[model samples]
Target: MSRLGSFAGDKMKTRGRKVRGSAYLAVPFVLLAFVATASTAFAATESTSKTAIFARVTWKVVKPGDAVDFDLQITNGARLGEDPVTYDLKILDLPEGWQEKFFYQGEQVKSLTLKPGESLTVTVEILTAPNSSTGIYQLTFMAYSWMAEYASTQSLSVELREPIREINLVATFPGIVAQVGETVQHSIVIQNRGESGESLRLSALAPEGWSTRFITQDKSEVSSVYLAAGQSITLALETETTDNATPGGYTLTVRASSEDGVVNALMELMIALREKENVSDFDFVSRFPEVTAEAGKSLTYPITLRNLSANDQEIILSVVTAPEKWKTAFKSGDTEVTRITLNPSQSLDLIFQATPPSEVSVGDYSIVVEAESGSTVKQVVFKAKVVGLYKLDVQPSTLYTSVTAGNPLTTTVKVTNSGLSPVTTLSIQVTAPSGWDVSFSPARALSLDPKDSYSFTVTVVPPSNTVAGDYLISVKALSDQYVSDEVQLRVTVEAPTSWALAGVVVAVIAVSLLIFIFKKFSRR
Candidate 1:
């Protein structure tokens, strides 16, 4: 019995040893797996911390059928000298029928590479469907780096709304003068101030028996025009007046309408008509009956003379009435003439010159000119208005000055109003050589009466390194109405006193040394 018990005990001991051996072998595998998991987790954390994604605007409000762009930057915050990492880009949770694309440097891209401590910019363009409903849509953009095993995501939202539609119509000249059997032309501008392009039909409503048409600058007639957003076009409206049209005022309506008639613009124009003058044996006309001239100046008027008589006739021209001390003359091709002969149905061009006195007051004067041929007589009235002249004269106290380098030189300048009117808002300006400084004591003046003058103190400083030479400086007086002639001043730059003294000392030393050398050699 003892022997049998011993055998059983030995078998139990063997089984216990095998169990312990199996446990010891499994402990190494478990520890190795734990260490591997910890290392992997550390690597993932390190990589994620070194990468980032950023977007300036993550939310925006947009209109239906509009494209939205989100600018994003992918940054690798890892230490420099590390290898570049390539990131794969993707869009998540995008609605169906909506298109998405990524662009880098204007080219479509699916992936981008960024060096350590460097960043790359990319654009995510999202195009919404034309018929998209008004609501808020959210989209996610993700970037994954295969080398670093890291990922970053950015969320963006867009609120779609209805678009605004608008149109503008403008008339350059809303009033026009026309004679019977004459075609009157008017200019109109159309603009589309909307978020999309549109097709607009142009039409005009005129009085009965009048024809109207819309034509472009190239003379091409167009019933409809296409205008893009913020686009403008100029069109001409031509209207024909009837031969027997009564003398009255009429209103014409101009309109521009979109394709759907939802957007429209309207403008009203006024047309005035008068009776045509009867035919006569002689005709005299002046295009400009009134003219504005400056005091102490001469003005000329162009006149047309036609002889409708059946025979050759001699016409006499003369000024019947004019302002006292004012001179008037009629010239044909630079030759003074008092009478001219013209054949039947012949025309002659004449120039009428009028000069106002220097001391003429500011007012309007009427002058009557007459032309007579046998029994037929024609007269024209001209109005001339004299306006005040604006002139400025800039004078300096001294035209020339001398200055040493690195020193300031001050001079007085006078500004005079040599005009017939007062000068206001006057200021003085000084232009000097480069690296020089200039300043004025009183920078601006409120007003200067006629023949009055104002004095200004100008200080100029030259740079320390300026070479000894001559430089030109200019000063001028300016006002809101006119600018005076530039007054030039010559500035002579000389060496500093210390430098001159030093040069003298050097010369004396050299002369003394030469004398000593000569005496010593003579004695030898």
Candidate 2:
């Protein structure tokens, strides 16, 4: 019985050892499972923390009365398969009386929702008061997500500066001339040289009995204009004088002002007035009473005619006296007319053309133009001084020649005066191929009278290495008062004599060598 009990105790001990071994093996598995679970929880916490707000530009400089904008982005870092998050937007520490608005996709919104791994862009616009003091301002913007229990905040700074408000008024023409009972127009430009735009009221102060108004490019009359920052506009200022207006210098003041009177611009313009002359029964006026031109060229005189009578009159026009063999006519804009009808206070512009004969002498000639209306007659005298014509001709002895390379060529050219005028200080110029030398004898002529001719000797030499080809040489005659057309001469160049002789010698030597070789080989 003692032996059986000892055996049972040993069996109990073996069973206990087996159970302890199983427990040791299971410990590592449990540890690995716990580690994996904790790691997953940490990853989730890290992803959620990435949900935040970001701003591209948090600081800016702006002028008072200006609007400032900040670009912002809201991101959701929730993992895929996660629910969307909604955020409430708010602005803190903003100045009093300042206006602020939040916009998403160009629409004002107080809150926005973003999907997992999604981002949304938003804008905040702030406007300061016109009279705001110049200083640095700070403001905070927040986006709160209740579901995530997170608040993302961004601080923005803005420096406000003094406002610039300037307007410039300028008159294109500060002075004008006009007669009594007449209206004149001037151009003026309005420019805004400020940081902001404004609506300006325009006014003009003129003398008594004179009216003024501004006209736009579209011809619409306007008393006010709107100008944008750094922009300008042009307008016409028209002034009308009364019938009884006196003849004197008058000053006009033009003004442009804003509604609050903070911005103003003033410009002054001067107007000169002259007295009206009494009207005559018949009037004839000529701006040009005398003219000088070549004998073959025509002369023109501009004449103005007015009839002050209270009735319509039939007028006759004619050239009563002129130089011999000269043709004169009255033209009203390319149409020939000898008679015309004029109403009271009406005027007509006439072109009187006088053409002299080609052989007319160089002297002053008198012309009388007459206009008759019943018993009324008006006459105007004009003078014409005729200068002789000018013409030049150039002639060459030959049009073509041939020469060997490195040889000289000789030719003769004649310059003639074909017209009535005398040509003086006449010279010759030659243009030839490259690497060629040219010269002229008796380089200049003192004078060449009408129908007179002068001869010049021309020499040309080509370079030794000149190519054997056909080339051209141009000769022209020039005077202080005239230039003649260019005359072209063609020249042919031949190879040098030595080159031909050497070629022949080479041929002979080749033939002799072939004969010797044939005779020597036959002996074998």
Q: For each candidate, what is the lDDT?
A: 0.83, 0.82
Instruction: Please provide, for model 1 over 343-445, each residue's C-alpha lDDT reduced to its tens digit, 9 standing for 90 to 100.
Output: 9999998988999877676789999999988877899999999887989999899998999999999999999988877778999999999999999979899
**Model 2 — TM-score against the truth?**
0.44
RMSD of each: 20.0, 21.5
For residue 65, model 2's alpha carbon misses the true position, in angstroms, by: 7.7
Off by over 4 Å in 2: 1-65, 69-136, 139-179, 184-195, 203-210, 216-222, 230-236, 245-296, 301-304, 308-349, 354-391, 396-411, 419-440, 443-452, 459-524
Cα deviation of 382, candidate 2, in Å:
12
lDDT of 2 by residue, 181-272 (tens): 88988899999999788999999999987999999999999999999999999999999988798899999999999988999999999989
Question: Candidate 2's error at 399, in angstroms?
Answer: 9.0
